[model samples]
Target chain A: MSDFIVGTCLFMCPEKERWMREREGLLHTFEVDEKTKHLKRPKADPSKIVKCFSRPAAGQLMPDTSELRPASVLLSTIRYLFTNVVTRVDYDWVMIYDFVFDRLRAIRQEVVIQRIRGPQSVQILEPIVRFHVYAGQRLCEKNISVFDTKINSQHLLECLKQLLVLYDELEEQSSMCNPNFEENIERLSIGNNRPQMEALYMLLHLGDSSALGRGISLPHKYRGKNVKLAMKISLAWFLKNYVRTLRLIQKLPLLLKFGVLSNLRLLRRDTFQIMSAAYNSKLLTFPGLKLQEILMYRDVEKLSADCKLFNLSFAYENVQFDARKFNKGLLLANPDMYFTVQTLQKYLPIILLQDDDAINDDSSS
Target chain B: MDSYIMQLRRAWLNQDGDVLADLLSLSHNHATNPQLGSDAAMTKAMEHLSAPFDDLVLHHIKVISSLNKDDALTSYAHQSAAIQSLAKILQLQKDENWMLPVMNSMCLDLRRLALKAEASKFGKNQKSGEVLEKCAECLMSCFRVCAADNRNSEDDTKRWGMLALVNQLWKVYFRINKLDLCKPLIRIIESSGLKDQFALAQKITYKFFMGRKAIFDSDYTAADEYLTYAFVRCHKESAKNKRLILTYLVPVKMLLGYMPKKSLLEKYNLLEFWELVEAVKRGNLRSLEEVMNKHEIFFISAGIYLIVEKLKLITYRNLFKKVYLVLNTHQIPVASLLAALEMHGVDDVDMDETECLVANLIYEGKIRGYISHQHKKLVISKQNPFPQLSSLNSN
Candidate 1:
């Protein structure tokens, strides 16, 4: 069955076809008996079928959402979430995130299915992708387990990929449609985010080679300072130059910085392990303040606690780094917050709706 | 036209896959007459042949004639049609992969024609690489049959055709920058346990690509392993191919602290890496920068700039090891390392960043020591402070 789907069309018997149809939720119909003037239902086949489904290869539209709300309602719902609701007094964030992510996903689904290929799609998607990143960071401050941080890196990438695809569509349409004046202006406006999206893609997939290579090749002029810094930090991460990586990441705009910090546990652990090997000394210790600064630890005590978890002993405000004492087998890195709660709340709207808000001002009117 | 039909029929009857492939050649059927492989010609070709072979003959003629008219898109279309027919024919063969030669040639041309078709669409509104991506799908259809031939005996199985298809797919993937897609296809080959059993040429091609992929993933040891296999076992006579392999093999090998011999680099005309080899060995960061900037185009184009950029770590390791050798002390001041970095024209590094540099080296076990922050000293391990990179990777 798997081979047949990807393979060229081939013949199959009706019995097998019927079996497959049964498995694929075979649609049953009522047949009218002319003589009796009554309807009869068809019988089901019990046998399993080893056959392929043949749908002619063509441009496939997304499946329809069974109960879609009107565009205005859906748009307003998202508007409420990112703007008014997110900025309201903080609530059960985990629960709120589920509600918000779902509402935004619905809007995205509606946009794609309805073929809403306009500045509106970018307006909708670009915000959603930003929310994934900033919310991912905000959730990190929750100090949940590493996986539970709601990082959702893959989902974030999916949103970004869709946003990029939309950009391509608009650019292609503008070029082919008329090369008209106003449409050209709108298309050129969307062009502003492409490099940023491209850079954001690399920051998310810091270790992915294709992403890094693509990021490096992006034209220097088009990439904004934050985008370029993100690219640079990605390269630094690539080379295991964590000091350079962390320092430059610190220089990124707050939201992009959060994106890099999401890798904090992994980076910190690897750095600890390396520092243990490099700083193998019983008498000599790395200063705690410097460690906190370079490693982005918000608290000195948590750093010592995490190091102890990794089999390193700390005392007298310095780390007793020894390679032999290091427990190489301990794979999990302790999760902690680098920013205070008040700080995170202060930047919520900006993080979630950076460029997404200005468009709303004029368009909402 | 009548004679061409006779030759194809004869090749079909004789089961001569190579001859059929040759006769199906679309590239060299140049200056075709107006009557050649026309719609009427296609009908005549199909009329002359019978079922199973008729589609094959018609597609071949159509492809050649389309090429004759310089219609790459149409040519690609007919070539794809040719492969679909080839897949049908290949499925019918039992206990032997006699038709693999036809599949191989036709698939090769399919890719070439696809690339040509994509190239001819320059300055258009269409997405670049769209044609090649679709071509990869066409190749996947053929790959599916080859991979799914589980019931066939080894001698006759279509599984042997998978590597060629995968190699073709890799080119498409790499060209389109879709490196991640190579993962699944790799799993199929690895699980099949036919790593070394395929033809030597195909194996070389496979290993070379896998080597480059490993480099991109930053797995230098695996990259070294694969590329060395291709480099040493690869035929020396194929200078062009060996030169190509060396493009990746050189930087990857250097990262593991093994420099290429001058004669070999000269032989391959890859002496650009030689100056790089010297700078890294001497811990001369300034010269390294110069060499890199001079050959920026070559290195970046080869996608080795990043990998070579990694060589800077090893350079630091080398430079610091020198400071250790001259001072010959377990405790070396951070100031000494700073001076060494400055001497080597590493202008941008400061004290904290210097410690970070040593921190990475110590972390990697290239050096066995730690930095004492208050005292501003780097404490070195007495036992093999600078271990050979090759030895470190071995452990």
Candidate 2:
């Protein structure tokens, strides 16, 4: 925590060819700091771009949730999440909060899919995970998932209702940097925080007691002692939703090209701070949350070095190491890969950690 | 009762390590005696030993033993830490820990007896031909011991033995040619209980034939028949075992040069094979290599090799040296080689690389006294492949 220079590479660097030109015919430039390398911020006015940028034709969401009208709302939330949160800030720096929020939004999509359907819903996990997997270039035409069964329409509608409320909270949380944003907006009524919190608690319980739900289990490994897989899953979901919302706002070119807008960076930065505060509250209750903490914690310098090293090992068999170490190192190196690692790391500890404290506590106490 | 077994079978087949570990511990607790428990439970557990599940079972058994001296299984929960401490006590490295014990158990008795007998024969200066015959007999007996263990079904034992031998030969091949190292092995497996005629030997022979022909030219149709028969029987087993089949069956399927039907692949969630191949194509070397090592199925690696070749994901020139190296050392059948080479980067330079590989193989064969180099071509006589060699040279 001292003055340890965290080695890192920012997504924006001077040499990177700016794909889009700004006003005054100037290209967005990333500067190599004395320590950190290649950091570039996206457009300054992300909202202006959001307002102007054209939407894809409505038919494109098909073979997925295209049949549901609420699907468009979720898609809009998705676009908003990317442009507002992810693309707004030059997330090329290893900021802990951005990583948390972005990963949260990605997780939210899974819930959204489930809400749009149900446990018995049409292939929930695949399309949801594939949304990001394809974004990360790890997907191809052959991808398939087993959990794609359809659900009752009523169940789907209920999930969609909850998701819409969650989306409203997310959008408000992400677009807060807009100075025009009032504390109490006339048209938008946010879902009560109590219900949001309650839904989370219920989902966590369902995770523990139910067998058919999202592969959650409370084996003897981490059964008691302190860690709750249910809570961790919920927190992970919340943060992923928040980050995806912010990303949607930032990535939209509508704000950046034309309009006067609030400082998007402030919204991103503040949302992350809020997430960290909430996470810290949970940490007091569950010390074992260190699994996710380690992921959020970054040594920028170490990561930068890891990214380069991992990239090289990609093509050579002589490179010796497991995929996890190489991937962790690569994630560290590339700040832009924050959302990617957070989403992956979210499930791993819950699935893999076999702490004996839970069982031991039962016997001793 | 069958339905109940099916559910337990599902948990086992899922390679649900945690669940299986729990079940194993429960079974051990119910067991009244430790030694009897270990051996008896292992025998009964054959139906539950799918590929990865088998590995987890072995790991759990070791973990249990390391914890309690008197009741490894029953006292599992009590001795988890002590078991971990035992790992340190044994100075067990990750790679060495899981594989070594199983290999040792399978090979130790044979290895020691073989060594002692050879030493005795040499001390009196017995005839060399007599020594060789004695060596062959000893090796055959070793395979039979593996083929006949009462702890598991004969098929499981034989399958276990074939896997052990393949692993052993892979370790040995770097220093010795396959012909020299596995000569006795080839003889034993060819006629031993692992023949296609044997029921338990079905899967073992399928794998044995695949490995045998993997590096040389010969009749693999019979080998394919054995494997296909094994494939039909695979449905009776667990998902973990099905995953195991992909290690070999996938390569065989590819050698047959067609994607397997959806039903077979679905049962195993075997798309990971295609993903690994895609990673290989995209130059994701780490993932590709990890999949090969994790899967530990030579046929899968060979299948990957074929896919890499077919798609031109790799250049033949770059892989020529390694292909040459593998060909020179192993007397795998030509068809197997073509199947293996079919998925690698040998397309544009196919003729040249094939010639180089063939020449290297021929030279090595001549040195091993298995073939003669005449008129700039190799002639096979009294070698491993026998009748298949005449047509192999042209291939």
Candidate 3:
């Protein structure tokens, strides 16, 4: 009996080794063939991968290892399978990624909320936060990805601000329910859990010069000239400064962010560099600055010298800034001030009427 | 005097261009050299120039005005002579057929004079506004004649002439701040089926003037519709005219919550408005004020100062959006909203005034919300806190 067992063990060892090498070969072929095959002729007929996962043989192993693998890991695994295996093999990958990512985010947020504050809070807060995030994602895809820099910046800032507000509300509600909730809530907070996304939000939605200076501290790889140009455009856009926006866009190199090969393709395709080119060629249209003036309407003449300095500081940060130099640059940059001045000159009658309080005060006195 | 009247009648009946031109020149010389003639002699000379001669003299004046060079007479001299002859013709002419042509020629002359006056430092012989008033009177008289003579009113040539005359008259009215005079003309155009008969350019011009008139009158619904119609129908190649239409249409569109495409504005050399659109979209009152001040001349000249100033309400509505974002709740506290308003330069605003402003916005259907005075809060509808300012779908 001992001699037979030794012979069997020796025989099975090579057979097992041969089986292991065959599985490795299969995985390698799967990676290469699956990628090339999917690229060549996409198939939408039900995936064989799905059959493998859904088979009863696979379900037999589930209960035994259920305790070993956490629910979150399993969820992540399923997400990976959907994004990588299922989505990659499918023809409509973009739609699949969008749908799967959106649903996954919602489920993750729901799980987090439920874990932190139970199902009751999920019903109250999940939909609002989900709506904002979904809207923000859609905005990013439609506006930002398409290089609609102006609307993209505005909507991003608004959406991020909304998210921050939701965070505060969640904090307030949880604290109200349990005074000791603060210490326990940190792990469950969406803002805390999604720090990378939060950083992106802060980086994009910066409002002031001070915030801009502080927020733009990304790693070296990401801190490129194209990125800076993008940020500068955003800042000028947020400030409602089209002159500055135009000037910045004009300064952007043709290759901007795309790789050299893609840049060549983009040049041929005329896609990536089209906006700046349009602006340079005077083909882009913008709303009148008069509307901006109305929104920012103030008695600048009434501003004290100190207040002027304060306002200047808000706009620019160079300690050695010369007002005359800046004014000269502004005037030189746009030769059409004549047209702008003429337009304003024509509306002098109505502009005078805008100061109804001053008119009424004079009459009353 | 009977001989002079008979000679003038014979010259007019024969369509004598030279005789009429010489007679106008003589009358103009007499009017200019007041010391040469007594008022009685001038009146006597005018008496010989009867209603029929008025048409003949005006025809001669049109010929003179068209002449590029006259050794002894400057263009201004010719224009003044034309105006003088026009005044005489308008004073004596009673026949509807004669009045219509006289008014048409007068409208053309006055427009030329207004353009000249605008270019010159001093109007010299005539005030542009006064000339514009004369043009308006001529347009009104044309309308009156057309109203009386239905046959002439239906005539395509006469109607086209009237449309062009009224369009020019509207520009004059705008320049002279006599927009109210356009009211009667608008009524006649609409009621008399003139609107249906307008050519494309006439249609664009009519809609533009009516749109502006509506904006001035605070009739935004009508203004939005009319301006959008004008903007859509305006030819793409006529970029300058299109920009002029957009000057008013943009603000109207914004108040109605329809933001114009930035690329569209830039293509038309209207990039100056981009900042304003951004300010209005973001509710940045400070930026709005700054942009307005920077381009004060542009907005004021566009005659959109009042319309843009009214956009402050829309700005306030945008500010409330930030409040909604920050608070992340439908029931926004009055204190927090007031703080937001204060940030936007409403420093002296109290709770009541803030609530009232909110109430006005709500009532205007801009913000779909209600003020809960008892709760010191505004309860915005969950559906759409900021209702879209929907107008006609513009191209």
RMSD of each: 11.0, 28.7, 31.4
Score residue A338 of candidate 3 by CA lDDT: 10
- Report the candidate with higher lDDT, 2 versus 3: 3
The digit string of per-residue lDDT tens for model 3 on A139-194 reads 22242343332443354345345444444444444434444555456426443322
Write candidate 1's Cα lDDT for B265-348 as tens digits.
998999998999999999999999899889987888888888988898889999999999999999999999999999999997
Give fnat for candidates 1, 2 and onward, in order: 0.69, 0.00, 0.00
Could you tell which candidate, 1 or 2, scores higher by lDDT?
Answer: 1
lDDT of 1 by residue, A49-167 (tens): 11222332488653323333334444455666766556766465666665566556656655554566567667667777777886777676464542355446677878888776676
Model 2 bad stretches (over 4 Å): A1-365, B1-67, B70-182, B192-197, B201-226, B273-395
**Off by more than 4 A, model 3:** A1-365, B1-106, B117-128, B139-143, B152-157, B344-346, B391-395
Q: Could you give candidate 2's per-residue lDDT for residues B1-395 as a string of tens digits? A: 23323444676445343443334342335223345235444444456555444443444444444333543222332222222332232232222222223333323322333333434443242332332343333334434445444354443343344445433343333212233555555566566554555435334434544543442332334444545655557666566754664555554444333345556666777765675444443434445546645654442333333322222222221233244346664333444344445564223323223333443333322112121111222223334421222233323
CA error at residue A308 for candidate 2, angstroms = 52
For model 3 chain A, give the 10-residue run with minimal summed lDDT: A330-339
Number of the top-ranking candidate, with TM-score as the measure: 1
Candidate with top DockQ is 1
Candidate 2 C-alpha lDDT tens digits along A1-365: 23322212121111122224332233222211222223243343322221111234677653232222233333443344333434334454223222323433433443443354221122222222223321321111112241111121222234334543344344434333434355335213332222222332223222222111112222232232122333333322222333322323222222110010122222223323322222222112212122122223123343234324543221221212222333322212222222233443333222111211222111111
TM-score of 1: 0.85
